[model samples]
Target: MARMRIQDIAAEAAVSPSTVSKFINGHYDAMSASTRSRIAEIIERTGYRPSSVARNLRLDRSRMIGVILADIRNPYSSAMLGELADRSAAAGYTLTCAISGNNPSKEAEAVMRLAEAGADGLIVNTCGGNDELLADTCDRAPVVLLDRDVPGASIDLVTSDNGCLVAALLQEVMRDGVDACWLLDEHNDASSVRRERTATFERGLRSACARGGCIALARNACAAAAQLTKMSCSSGGSPIGLIAINGLVFERLVEALAVAGIDVPGAARIATIDEYPWNRVLFGGVTTAAQDIAGLAAAALELLIERIERGRGPCGSRRRIEIPGNIIARRSTRTDSGPTTTTPQPLRAHR
Candidate 1:
């Protein structure tokens, strides 16, 4: 029995070593479909998987990446980290993941510890309020900003393009016959400039829809569903629509709705940004603006690897990549059977 190698696989597949390397690294944009298929077949037939020890030795590098999360328990963060790790493994890199539990000080501490341990590169979904420290760390090594973005920091970012997506979501909801809508969120979360900018868009759009104006509303997210249910009742006692600011709020709203025994697409047409595996099946699929998780993960890795292997990037240009979100309509936000635009639209569709 002998060992298999990338060069051997490259030869077997009749492709250049670099091309095989790209395939292995999950960089297939430049590779043709036939070539990709052929490589995939050869790899499958040969049971060829990269050897980490050999890879590290050949590259003469650690081949380890650091991933810092604001809250690992958050579905969004967990999903992204899983995708990032899967992509990293495909590229022969190992990951060291740290969770900050949404604490700024803990985030800073975790990042510092990871850096001190000598990770080849770093990717972070930052907790708010640690700009200067992160900037300093970026000066020393390649850093990729994931999910959350910092203001005035020169780093590559991969996140959803929120402006148009939020507008589109609102349009779809309006078209679905939601007369009124409420933006549900904790409101006190310390969003970076990026998150705040998106929130501003959501607030503005929601305000315009609700009162023909955007006014600051006191946010009590945990109890939003009950309050909105109370406020939305018409002269005939009907339910209005609710939009969760993100998945976190969505969960809270769902719980509130359940405890209150109100039905979705019945009492309220519900939707939110961010996606998770359970979401598609939850309540016959929940309406959401789901971002391309795999694409975001690959793009983040590409930026990190470029910096790690190529030294400094272009003289002065910083990379900001925004992937658009997709509209997912489900039972949660569908038009009720009777009069599409009038009355409470009671949660009749599901129950």
Candidate 2:
């Protein structure tokens, strides 16, 4: 038996091949509901799969967008990607994703591959040290930075206000009467967001210490949790509080704390900058600053569409949009006055 083509479906539906193609590509404007239904039914009956290569050649567009993430294992990154995909689909575009695994070289290679694949635009949660390659790509195509920044690349960016997030988390720790505080550092190059968060954390710590407190830094989440455990075990006195910079760091902290058999809020306190569904259920909810994933997705998509429409290279006129994150007060690192119980809810509800 021979395979059916789009022309067969178009003929059955009594529509032009271009009209059927436009409908298949999700361009519903100017298409009547009846026409859409007829075309959809015919295509389904015919088992027609539009050839993406032919469609691209006909329309001069791949009708696809690319998204790159530093690590897809992180729940936050995955959530953002999901939201971005939905928004892009609604806008008549498909999304292709690549995971860099936090490696700069891999990130660069992924960017080049996506560009070569004829992605109309790119949304990147960049790995550090790919700024030059990113700049070169932006020079050729529309690029939007998501969740992280690339220095010296003048492109539209959508990210949470990490500075305010860390500052607010530290404020809660101070209010809880934590005598000493520690930061779990995940070492990456000084991206704009990371630099801002570090500076804000230091400033907040300085202000808190003037009122009588101390802050320390750990190499990473595992080390920070370990040090906190050792300090709490050896001293047998006041409790110490620790702050994880992101959801990935928080997971490592939980693993380290569980290995050491440390009871959160009893032996020590814990807080972090981001929260997902598991955080609410696993540890009686962790106090965290939550980013607006939906808003971030909308903003990124808007910028990308604008850039594509303008056909402009990455330049000084592009805006850096920093969306504010909200503080979720949970039991893990909160003071005695903090909420005693928090019901586990879908993270999507918070958005």
TM-score of 2: 0.76
- lDDT of candidate 1 over 249-297, digit per residue (tens): 6777777776666776676676777777767776676777777778889
- Scored by CA lDDT, what does every candidate get? 0.71, 0.76
Cα lDDT, model 2, residue 40: 85
Scored against the true structure, residue 78 in model 1 reaches a CA lDDT of: 78
Give the top-scoring candidate (TM-score): 2
CA shift at 164, candidate 1, in angstroms? Answer: 2.2
Task: Give the range of the ten consecutive residues with the poorest summed lDDT in model 2.
Answer: 342-351
Candidate 1 has its poorest 10 consecutive residues by lDDT at: 342-351
